[model samples]
Target: MSLDTQSPGLLAEPQAVQATADGGTRLALRGDLLDFTHQPEWGAIESDAVRFREDHWLLIEDGRIVGAQPGSLAPDASWTRHDHRGRLILPGFIDTHVHSPQLDVIASHGTELLDWLNTYTFPAEKRYANLVEAETGAARFADALLAHGTTSAVVFPTVHKVSADALFAAARERGMRLITGKVLMDRHSPDGLRDEAPDFGARDCVDLIDRWHGVDRLAYAVTVRFAPTSSPGQLAMAGQLCTSMPGLYMQTHLAENRAEVKWVHELFPDARSYLDVYERAGLLNARAVFAHGIWLDDDDRALLRDSRAQIAHSPSSNLFLGSGLFNWRAADEANVRVSIATDVGGGTSLSLQRTIADAYKVQALQGERLTAWRGLHAATLGAAAGLSLNEEIGSLSEGCTADVCVWDWTQGSVAQRRHELARNLHERVFAWLTLSDERNLVTAYVRGIARYER
Candidate 1:
């Protein structure tokens, strides 16, 4: 039996059941579906593997994909049909590193890395103490992320526990897959920004884990503002928290600027390298997501590879701050899991498309090319792998959550002209990469529900 023969009643029901082909049950997608799986680009070393299918039928039930095929539907099966023929569909983008409270400070004038933090980042982050302000910021942050086709993010809130709570609360209301935590810093910060005591800060982090971790789609992270601002005592406590909470994620900046690297050397003279500071603190592991690994040596790369920690490549921020170009080839050669992200407010744009564009430039500077398929994968499946969330949200594979993005491939005149001239799926993908932005995202869906539509 063909899927089209299946009655609409079955598709309308919420209960998910396996449908036998002979029993006349089939599922269908009612529009032009651009399944990212069409052409899979595994990574920097992998060959082109992305695929594209036209006039496709995707069978989803209970927020999980049950089946997908080209050109037809199962017969005698009931299916929920969504007509999106003129749209482009892809997996929801995953932003691996972002500062939720820093939403207000994005695009502020900045010097270099350390100076930028002291001048703009720290002072802006200090305002999260008020629950009302935090709540407002969280909501705006969530809205901006969703509007830009980001269904999941690993966010950094301010040092205030209320800030983390605000972000988690906002995420819960939107059914977003979010990871966030309070910034833990006990020294070297402005007076108002410092936590009263290291132990007290650690206790708050522990309490937050119990309260917010695993709540709905929310996950808690053990966040440190890098080794410079955190003393040995605080780092040790954070490491203890990681040990106690085996599955929690660890996020912090790493080797982004020359000054920061020099400071790490001065701060931990006994440590072999900057990465060693975190390694000795028991914070290096597969669950850890280190942002901006731009200045790493062979030793640092090797240690990171051995520990299986992932890197969140923020190309836009790196370029905007004049930090340095990230060695994509080096990270790939070391077998490190790499994911692309818009590290906004430091990252000038919220659009993942812009981030991808920046990544291409960053790679070009290193005499490499970042293909469109690979860029999309990095923003989706690659990111999901980095976050250990591949089974849940990365692809539109069977049993994955139905978080998806619908793009208007010809959203603008330039894009339309390019689309008309493009001959194949790969060319079209490249064109979109070069020309598209958040403006091309027609709709954003989370867990089978539409959250934003333009």
Candidate 2:
């Protein structure tokens, strides 16, 4: 076997079943279908603000939701039926920011952002140089995401080109929509992790983009580790790649930590702020996603808003690293798109439910409350919009992909109690978001295929 196929056990094997022929495939999912038509803001009451259809049925054919309606009957007798009685069916979670190589080091104690990267993150990521090891890590990481009900993600693979290939390969085999790139860092990182030269880094990114961008469900991103890790030449190449490639995504860190922010300012004294580093590099655009935007000032926020750039709010990672609270409300007020994320390794959990819980707490600390509807929307439709992927995987709307999660609201004790006393949909959803984890996921589907089942 080739190196990439040597460790197949590292991935969670799906059940032995053949996919039904494309046109002949029709699967009917019956449950309480929950979908968001728009970003749901907090309110004293819950109405049709967020759409939830009890006793609903969705028709799936060729991996897309052909039709969805509030009824119990399938339109045709040839359809396969999945009867999720009493469970809640919602759009699968979309995590906009996560590091696949750092799954092993998740929850590791560290001093701060820069120190954390030098001490634990870089050392761990450097191991992905081995194609076999990278494949194994990618498989495990992808499985972990499925187990936690994430059907799509914007990922950061290691600087190793093989790392990006391995991750995109595994995600392709499972039909998961993953957007990632070969990390472009030409300075300040360890010897093994940093690119040898600026042109070499740019060439690797271009090659990876050629090999994987727009292939299958995989899309390419131009990833600079951050402002401090990339030299000006490397950043310019990354920006050039972003502008040259159509539909290409640009992802990197922003004002995640105070020290990191100060370092960026010191490193690029000509720039106005940390955001300006990428802005001046011509990397700010609607397709760009900056992670952990916790320390942005008004000017920075305005720049982001003006550029139509997006932010991946990694509340769990921010809290774990003692990074300052993100002013998501301010971003929203400024019309800057913000989506929830699990910045793994630096972040403690892969589960979006846990991230949502952390986000609730984080926003609470800022005296800004996020409703359960809004929080769920952030991980689903809101995140999809942030990543410029709304038409594909974020909702239960007809013609959308069948990436969905079935939640057993009566499973855990807290959920059971909520099920008993819950008079409204909002109350039950709030309880579940606050109290649920991976255990609450009865099953998770990606493109109409069952990848994880409890």
Candidate 3:
């Protein structure tokens, strides 16, 4: 466990759907369509997994994908199409793990995971007890995410019910797909931040689940602060909630740092490894997402694969907090679902563009290359699949909500140069990951509605 820390074209304005003659709302965006059909290989780009079509039309009807048609379209008033031929369109980036409360603590100068939590993270989260504070913070956090071309995320709010509700309400107001829960830390935390002292905060979770979960594209997670902060009874209670609530997700930290792993061992002397603590508590499942799985043994990796739980690779946080680099290739080879995330506050930024660049550096340091296909897949469909929400979001398929981003490769002088120097689609797109940021985003849509723009 640890503490730590686009495009072009369209006008930067929100839009409401236009009505057709048949009394239905339709919006079609014409651009270069790109999305992953499946997870690509670890180091190399996969041809079959990628679906890239130039000058295609992504048809959206009533906020759902109807189809993606190719070639020129007839000038019909049945739908409104946004021309973005030079821009790229793909499923919005899905951040599997992040801290909404910790947004204030981002880039705060701190040493390591544990110390950073006590110093910057706790004080900031404590302020979330105020509804106004929580509401304002959540609004900024949600807006910041959309501004960076992320339409969906699994977030970590503070332990306060108000904090969790504020985030849910913010996402709801904007129609963004989001999942979050009140942080559960019954012990090992400051007075104001810990949950009602010692019962794992299940009652609060139930209250929040009833209020926010499954309401307007928002979901609830059984959020454990991490292994160190949660007592045995608390972890067991968290597991019980997962069992009682069929579709509820479980999120927490794992073997992120050397000291944290050692701490987990000390806390749970009978457990074989850090992951074993959660597994014994019945927390291992397909819906469970553990971040920073960098210290586990081969056996732990195998267990995670067999249990169908996923690991979120947070490279910037690992780098900023001095946590070790994650062996994403190893976990994928072991058949474990691995997704990339920002893990912000503990990480440095909410931009997945910068996060992926850091991921490439981290992977390259380990002698493995992260191709554009593999990296983008990890950010989008792979993350959605890991959270078992691939069918609902994260793709441009019929009936899925239209969470999409239109991006430009030629934003600034350097990106324009990179676009010119590129030889193929892969190279230019790879340059988008490295050379581009939120400024290149033309429009980011949540369910066919443009929520953010350049």
Q: Which candidate is the best by lDDT?
A: 3
TM-score of each: 0.90, 0.94, 0.95
Q: Write the per-residue lDDT of candidate 1 for residues 1-454, one digit (tens) a residue.
A: 1111222111112223345455433334544555445324334333445545666666666556676676455323466455567667888899999998777778888488888888998888888888898998888888888888899999999999999999999888878999989998988889777776637397789889999999889999999988999999889998988888778999999998988999999999999988899999999988999999999988999998998898899999999999999998888878887889899988998888899999999999988888887788888888888788888987878888878777877776878999989887767877887888887877677776667766
> Model 2: residues >4 Å from true position, as ranges?
1-23, 42-48, 74-76, 198-200
Name the TM-score of candidate 1: 0.90
Tens digits of per-residue lDDT, candidate 3, 1-454, equal: 1111122322234586778877878988988898888887766654778889888989998889989888496336878878888788989999989999888889988589889988889998999999999999998888889878899999999989899989999899889999899999988989897766455688889999999889989889999989899888888999999999998999999999998899888999999999999999999998999999999889999999998999999999999999999998888789999888999998898889899999999999999989998889889989899888889788888888999999886787878988898898889889989988887788889888888766
Residue 370, model 1, lDDT? 83
Off by over 4 Å in 3: 1-14
Q: How accurate is candidate 3 locally (lDDT)?
A: 0.87
Model 2 clash pairs are: none
Ranking by TM-score: 3, 2, 1
The deviation in Å at residue 403 for candidate 1 is 0.7
lDDT of 2 by residue, 1-454 (tens): 1122433322255433224555446678788888898887654356465888898887788778887776656556667777886888999999999999999788787568888998899999999999899999998889889888899999999999899999999899889999999998888888898887637487777888888889989999899899898999888888888888789999999999988888988999999889989999989999999999888889999999998888999989998999989988898889898888999988899988889899989989989888888788889998888877889989998889989888887665656877789888888888878778887887788888777776
Q: C-alpha displacement of 329 in model 1, angstroms?
A: 0.5
